[model samples]
Target chain A: MFLLTPVLVALVSILMVWIFKNSDGGTERRKGEARAQAEACPWVDEDLKDCTDVHQVEEDANGWQESEEDVEHIPFSHTRYPEREMVRRSQEYYELLSKRRSVRFISNEQVPMEVIDNVIKAAGTAPSGAHTEPWTFVVVKDPDTKHQIREIIEEEEEINYLKRMGPRWVTDLRKFRTNWIKEYLDTAPVLILVFKQVHGFAANGKKKIHYYNEISVSIACGILLAALQNAGLVTVTTTPLNCGSRLRVLLGRPANEKLLMLLPVGYPSEDATVPDLTRKPLDQIMLFYFLKTS
Target chain B: MFLLTPVLVALVSILMVWIFKNSDGGTERRKGEARAQAEACPWVDEDLKDCTDVHQVEEDANGWQESEEDVEHIPFSHTRYPEREMVRRSQEYYELLSKRRSVRFISNEQVPMEVIDNVIKAAGTAPSGAHTEPWTFVVVKDPDTKHQIREIIEEEEEINYLKRMGPRWVTDLRKFRTNWIKEYLDTAPVLILVFKQVHGFAANGKKKIHYYNEISVSIACGILLAALQNAGLVTVTTTPLNCGSRLRVLLGRPANEKLLMLLPVGYPSEDATVPDLTRKPLDQIMLFYFLKTS
Candidate 1:
């Protein structure tokens, strides 16, 4: 009986290992098969046809000469963890996002640089156009630069809000109690200007074209918002309030790059106040085959 | 020393409790204040204005009836986990999406009904326009309906692909090796007819206004894609290769809604294949700023 026990135990252990290894192998095989099928797909590239006549993206993809040494390789497995805390994580995420307050007024006490950096690092993780990541964040810390930006923004906003450029749409914006006057520009310690570069060069100077540029940038913005909320910081996502051309002239951005958003990031002032706005209901924002996703 | 022990213990414990209570209050206060600030911020409204006409919204808001719930009662948490396994998750997501191959040729082998319903249920949670959600997903499973849809879709697609629309865009689409012949419409067990409601209701037979209809619908699509991926199903996001209005007429959609995307949702054929396109890298898709907001 004692001899039989060891033999039985060995069989069970071997079986367990085999099952685990088999499952892992099965997943990989499935993925590879899926990828193979995807590669054979001819429909997704349906738009690629007339490229022979006008422009093909092949050159843009091939010429990049970014050196591995200079390029930051974000280690893929830096934050591996077990699955037990997903529910807790989801709860915290909801709680933090629920705390997301769009603030305008700023007393501008120094924010912990570490926190700001961490949030940006998170934002950097946002998905982007053509994977071009096609954005440049320029933080204007100087008060003078902030004023310069504010002036430029207000000037363009004034034109948009008052002139023909803004349709009934812009006029309606007036009801929301907003003006071109941005006080946070001067008050906030940092102004992060997000730029979307429409196209860039690989080392061979072949241009890299981005697909769904706006959508990609917008996703990145969403991720950034989530990260900032997680960091216990307050932020106001402010658009240029102006156009890219004017802002480009003001900020001296290259032609390939356009200003996407101007963010004023800081702590809320001690006595800052906000308007009593409300979000649309869940029934309003969510739609399905008439069900909820989460 | 024995006598002193009780007194000291009592004092320290009381102090500890007091500190804990104060910190709790502080947290509550901060949370309340932060949400209030978010609600009242001009920027929040300002951002909304970009998506919805504030004047029309104000008119609605002014006459708005309060919901049974209080402002603080609402929640907007997606998940608590940031998903520490970036590579694993990214790979998972890619695999999930990669599975969304266009199934032009489907076999009516009677797929499980829950697989289809569960996917649609997940899509319903997408955050969108004025929270209007503004989308309708109609699942077509019957063979007759599928055939009719395929016939109708192909009729318009032939015209579109042959030449009747924007040249640059349509021409580009052809390279991907796609034509409007939708065999899967008849073959798959389900066809998702997605509509983007351009306008909203008038609670009292009035045209209720919606802001940023297109943007709202677009976000909903993103959510739908995410939900579908999460559910272990696959779909092709098929923008009409034909005039939306023409397709609408063919599909018998309401006059107010537009044919946005026709999703063919189901499992891939055992031998289905796709183009071997590479997804853009993380750095290429993400950008960072000096300040971050989650």
Candidate 2:
């Protein structure tokens, strides 16, 4: 009986430990499930995942100071126009940009490469965080390569539609009449793939962090869109779901670069149609705090 | 002695449980420390923190489809230019944009509010993900409010430089000659604070997830920058570190909105100087994959 009592004490201790460990394990299991859920959603691309916190402080802290430490400051020349001309220019620019639409049906006719180059140059002028300018513009004009890209994007997008994306997302896109089949990918004469360099190498080959890289790249994209519109070309902005890695590998971009956006640039097809969409009026989108002029 | 054996066994068992719990507690403590470290860094603003994974699928999943379901499709009209005009326009646009610099020195002269209105309107035309158009432009023209903003930003920035930002980051920004004192915030005629709507309410008051809201808003800011340059105004793009929530509250913006970028808009001061930074050449930034015509 005495021996059994000792055995009972030992067993009870083991039971207590198991109970505590099991509770902790439950929390760990829940975290694992959450991560799994995130991975299952293909629209939540790995590329979109924010790793800035991980390397923000560790890598080359500031590219602007590091790169331009030796460069001299120059007087910024002014380009001030008369108030009348300023108003006229701003009004005309607004009118021009307001006419831009995300045209999907791009004609197969070849566009001037010089125009494309100029538009990209305009995009490069966007101000980046710490002036990193962490972007790569890959222009693909090969029909075979374009077809391959389309195939990869379509395959992943099909999975995104059929399984990965929930019913809600599918329902949300119903108005656009968009599907996994991307006809413009095959028909558009040029595909400009924009990549954001997550990090660049310093002169010593150490990693240099690109701060706010995704935002910077997207800003450049906005300028690109405006330039295209100004030149009377048309394109659609697309971030192909779960296709960044595949496209990156296919295009032979370095590990530091991740696909941010894809633009199929060309002229609009004759039968192209757009959903009659109107933007919110200025009052709705803007708020002003002006000193009460007595 | 017989009674003592059972007590001894019980004590030993308790010791085992304590050891196991202590090891688990160590891991939990480490995690807490890591989180605390992240909080200590002021530049790692909560506003810049990515929360898309949390509500991405939960809120209005497909805003494009939901909002535009009833809207009718219309034939798209496009303005096409001849090849020569397209090239000329693209080249001129590039030259105009390339001249744009992040001008920090601003004159106290008031800019025409109408031009500001037109530029914001042009920014509103940028494309958004799922047609969410999730952005708000807060134009602060009241001098008192602008001074208040400068005070808040300077206070936070002082903390960022002295305490939160490590020596490495301070060194990184040394070349820019930027400090906590922001005279432009008070001197510039307009302080355009761009905010991103993380989530919006649908017509039914249900939460609508703004997919890619940050990127969308940044794109708008890019177009806004272009418009400012086209109108011959100069401004510097500033994302005040750790100043989002306070500035948002100061501007009386809603909880759903978070400040993304702040621009001090007006004419450049006479002595305005810029860091003579050159962008990456076109060939360096771009790669082409062209099919060989047999």
Candidate 3:
């Protein structure tokens, strides 16, 4: 549905190109207006701009055909850090991340919409499998929608905690003491619902399978959390098991889309508290093998 | 398997506490030495250290038992950023990430082992599902292992390109010009095989179910990629769809672990190039609903 507009626009340009190629064209006065419109609407196809100028249509088509013929590549560019700076940055980032906690008590204090936008944009930069970019972010700040989502989650969580989860699972969660109730869902000013698109419809309306949709969405969500943390916002990753369909219905997302996680984004409340948990040390989490030494 | 060591240490400390409580046998000198040793090893439990200090053991146990009485909570801490700095950092990070590309041609230039270590450490900080953190990263630098992995991946990729993937998939991949050949696997100096542990063995040998294992691991992998990129290293995510079992066998990981992705890490070759692709514009990926406006 998202790409349909672009695809339709491209098709219209293709038709325009066909007409310009065959017709005894309009005056230069009309052509100038078309060029101005094309320049203004940057979203329009470049070929359409050339189509308006009949003299350049053939040349543009030739260039397009050539590009279609050979695969193109661009030089990779990156910023290199000095050794000390790299180390310092790594240390600082590690320290910053170490302080991050899975906060549940989120303040209803209003977060600027721009903060949420930038975080989502940062998330969009994540590399996806096959560059499918098969994910969508839905930011819901409406009271009613958040209420609906909270209701759907609590209901499923009730079953999950009471019956679906095994005794060991329940015991494991004893320290966290999380229950069926999810007040934070309605408490946070913004709820970012991450949706994973399993497949997409192509320009030709054919079904295009997305490779590693689960992994791609997870990666994006991870980046989202980090971005939010970097912005000094707080969140906890909450997955409502057995509520995917309910969430889809409420969010008005398509059948192919699945709710990956619901993040309640905001500031930590004045009395907010989290489990005093310690991360596994590097010795436990990592094993290094230097080739020179090994 | 991972937490067993900590649990064992805790058990030994519990025994020591029992002994100290039953008979006040140890002299002040011996007690002082034990307390000093515990202080030296801060990663060892604070409870264990308190146990060594007789006067504090009762108080600590009372605190611990009550924490065990109900769920415990600690204050969440974060560093706040000034407005300008926040904007600048976000823009810089976005720009840095924007330059990141899935480089295929890698130079086997020697990257300091410390760099890889720090990058992985950054990735390890990603929040996990229910705090499970169920992931194991296997860094394979041995030439023989890399060669074996390359072989396994290419074999499956060949089959994938030739048979398994639909025509639409192949057509979609046409622009990337990627085929079954994956020489970068061998050309790169290091390969990190990320494994997702579906469940873990607890200290008591009971099976512990990890929630959203796929999502948790994916998030870590994503952060790993970004961390590597931030460190000026290049990598491409390669998932060998059918070779998880083989990889598990090769890597000596247990049955519970599933190989998620294999990333070949190194500097991009001087002549390396990537497809010039634009990310989907922000408007397409994000929908914002501000409470005040809505």
DockQ of each: 0.02, 0.56, 0.16
**Could you give candidate 1's per-residue lDDT for residues A1-294 as a string of tens digits?**
122345445654665565555546545755664454322221111111111111232223244232222222221111212233323333333444455556677767766554555445444543332244555666677776678778877886676556523343343343335677888888998777766665556666755444344444544555555455445455676655335666666666677676666678876776655544454443443233322237
Name model 2 segments beyond 4 Å from true. A1-33, A36-43, A52-68, A290-294, B1-44, B50-68, B290-294
* Clashing pairs for predicted structure model 3, backbone only: none
Q: Score each candidate by Cα lDDT.
A: 0.50, 0.83, 0.69
Distance from true location, Cα of B33 in model 1, Å: 54
State in Å the error of residue B67, model 3: 15
Docking class of 3: incorrect
* lDDT (tens digit, per residue) of candidate 3 on A1-294: 122345445654665564454332323434654555433221222211101122232234232111122357888775678777777666666666667778889989888777777888889998886687988899999988899889988987887778665454566678897899998999999999888886555565544556667678888887787777777888988777768778777777777677777799988888888887767666666653343434
Top of the candidates by lDDT:
2
> Using TM-score as the measure, which candidate wins?
2
Write model 3 residue lDDT over B113-199, tens digit each, in one string: 777777778778888755778778888888877888889878977877786654545666777888999989888988888877765
DockQ of 2: 0.56
What proportion of the true contacts does each candidate reproduce?
0.02, 0.68, 0.42
Q: Please state the Cα-based DockQ of model 3 relative to the true two-chain complex.
A: 0.16
lDDT of model 3 at residue A174?
A: 80
Q: lDDT ranking from best to worst?
A: 2, 3, 1
The interface root-mean-square deviation of each model, in the order shown, is 32.0, 3.3, 25.1
